[model samples]
Target: MLLPLLVALLPLSAHAAERQVVLIAHPQVTNAALTRDTTRAIFAMRQRSWPDGQAVRVFVLPNNHPVHARFAKERLTVYPHQLQLAWDRMVFSGTGQAPSQVGSQIEMLERVATTPGALGYLEREYLDDRVQVITME
Candidate 1:
């Protein structure tokens, strides 16, 4: 019974390990790393500037996107619905704005790469030289 259970779980574990989500930023952004709290604040749109005082332009996938959900839960330690609620509240209250939403991961990569001081997240498989991976400290 134990052996069968282990075998049954192996593929799920392997698939989980394979889908690594990472924070990515434009190369022009000076910061190389950020604390998870700061990252969360940025994604939440509560924090608007990088530590160096450069204006931060945040990009994101739609709330229903799988990568967006995973990144919100795994990296930011928040649920996608919670993030959406926060954004909606901000918009309705007129106190802040939501991040720009891209239709796909490829668009995310393109926007982050081309926009100065842009920050976003992507799966490991989608990474390339166009954007720099920001280490989450």
Candidate 2:
């Protein structure tokens, strides 16, 4: 019985370990401050700008990556398919547009770290000097 329980718990433990999403801002951005709620709202198009008064521009993956999957499952509070439909509806209605999609994590980080007002997420392994990490908590 203990063995069975441990087996089940192993996957759960591994999942918990994967919860982190490394958020990064452009290197030139002087204000590195961000709250998780504010970040989420900004990415969802529910909020507009950073408190320091920079217009927010979000970069996202192309919706098939495991990191992107984690983002949708945890942060966005909606599935990828649902988010896509909502994004498309907004684009068609002109309410707002979806965040610009980058081809991969490398591209997303590369672009975000250079573009003003840019934000993107990646695993910690991809971290580089060009981007300032935003604490999600």
Candidate 3:
């Protein structure tokens, strides 16, 4: 029984180890780092500026995207469904605007890399020179 259980869990562990999500921003963004709480607020669409006070332009992949789901849960400690609900509530209630949505991670990377003060996240494998990684404190 123990051997069978170990075998069953091996693939799950391997898959988990294969993914690494990271916060990224336009190269021009002035803030060097952010605390986890600030990152959560920014991605949650609650905060509107960097610590330096530059306007924050947030981009996001479609809610159903795998990378989006992982980034929300792992980096922001929020569920994708919960994020959708929050965004919906904000939009419908006139409290806030939804983050600009991209159809794919490639597009998200492009948008953030080119847009001033932009912010978003991507899996490690998709990263390139166009954007800078925002280290979480």
Candidate 4:
């Protein structure tokens, strides 16, 4: 009976691990970590530059994408729809521009790695050495 229970729980643990999301940046970025507030500001397009004065290039997957939704909710503490609404408001009011949208996680990884001062999130399985992970405080 205990063996059966352990076997059933194994998949649950693996699924949870697979859902983990991490913030990533271009390898040239000097900062190794960022505060959650600052990150939220950047993603919202309220912050335009890094602390070192480099222009920030924000990237994101579609609002409906599972990884996008998970990152917004778990990392940023905001719903994906809320982000979309904020972006729409800023765009309409001529106050800000929305982040560039990538079509898939593969594109997200490639864009962040190639673009200077780039910032985005990806699931752990998609991560590699081309980009650096920025830990959130």
Candidate 5:
């Protein structure tokens, strides 16, 4: 009885769970020296591209986006609200602004894939052979 119901709902749940925005770089990207702090710096536009020689562009999900929440916590090492405070703090301190935000995972994926020198995040589920996944190493 319940088994059939659970089986029926599994696909929907799997679909819903497919929203992880993996950071990515170009296929020609050769350097793997980026750490979370460095990645944050680059994504925030605080730092530029790799020393190995590639143009740099940064991207992000929208301000209130749930995809951004994971990035804010895990990579940026701050909460969304806290990150907002950090940006404000930086602004007053004569520092930099945050990365420009895209509206959705699909948009982010498309932008980064099509734009040269671009870097961005989109749900891992949305990833294909189009972009090269950038890992923090």
Candidate 6:
């Protein structure tokens, strides 16, 4: 009975582990905030600069990463597979460049914190002093 109960609760525990994602930018990025559409554009590699005209550098985790999937769906309103295909098309067609890919959340946070004009998403717990949280408007 105990084993059966535990199995039933597994999905709940996994869901509980998921946290809201925050759009974090390097301290040097001039923009203080971004709209949902603009944020989507930035992640989609469609927008290359901050609203203030400063160059925007983007970072992302691997397509299969949980945080990447959540952010792609919840915040960007796009699926991870779609984003991957879009990126591949852009790279292949010479229309755009892909966002820099990091191996893990820790690496993502570290790169975004140190690189100027950088932007990436992180679960709330991964946030730190080195990066600024860009509020979604």
Best model per TM-score: 4
Cα-based lDDT for every prediction: 0.94, 0.79, 0.89, 0.95, 0.74, 0.90
lDDT for 105 (candidate 6) = 85
TM-score versus the correct structure, for each prediction? 0.87, 0.77, 0.85, 0.92, 0.72, 0.85
Which 10 consecutive positions of candidate 6 have the poorest summed lDDT?
13-22
Query: Model 4: which residue pairs collide?
Result: none
lDDT of 4 by residue, 5-92 (tens): 9999999999888769999999999989999999999999999899999999999999889999999999999999999998999999
lDDT of 3 by residue, 17-108 (tens): 55688899999998879998999889888898998889999999988899999999888888998888888989999999889999988998
lDDT of 2: 0.79
Better of 2 and 3 by lDDT: 3
lDDT of 1 by residue, 1-137 (tens): 89999999999988776678889999989999999999999999999999999999999999899999999998899999999999999999999999999999999999999999999998877889999999999
lDDT of 5 by residue, 15-74 (tens): 766755578865566754468887776765667667666767777776688778887777
lDDT of 6 by residue, 35-95 (tens): 9999989988999999888889999999999999999998889999988888899999999
| TM-score preference between candidates 4 and 5, better one | 4
Give the C-alpha lDDT of model 1.
Answer: 0.94
Off by over 4 Å in 4: 1-4
Can you tell me which runs of candidate 5 are displaced by over 4 Å? 1-18, 85-98
Task: Please give the RMSD to the true structure for each candidate, in Å.
Answer: 2.7, 3.9, 3.7, 1.4, 3.6, 4.4
Worst 10 residues of 2 by lDDT: 28-37
Collision count of model 6: 0
TM-score of 2: 0.77
Residues forming the 10-long window of minimal summed lDDT in candidate 1? 13-22
What RMSD does model 3 have?
Answer: 3.7
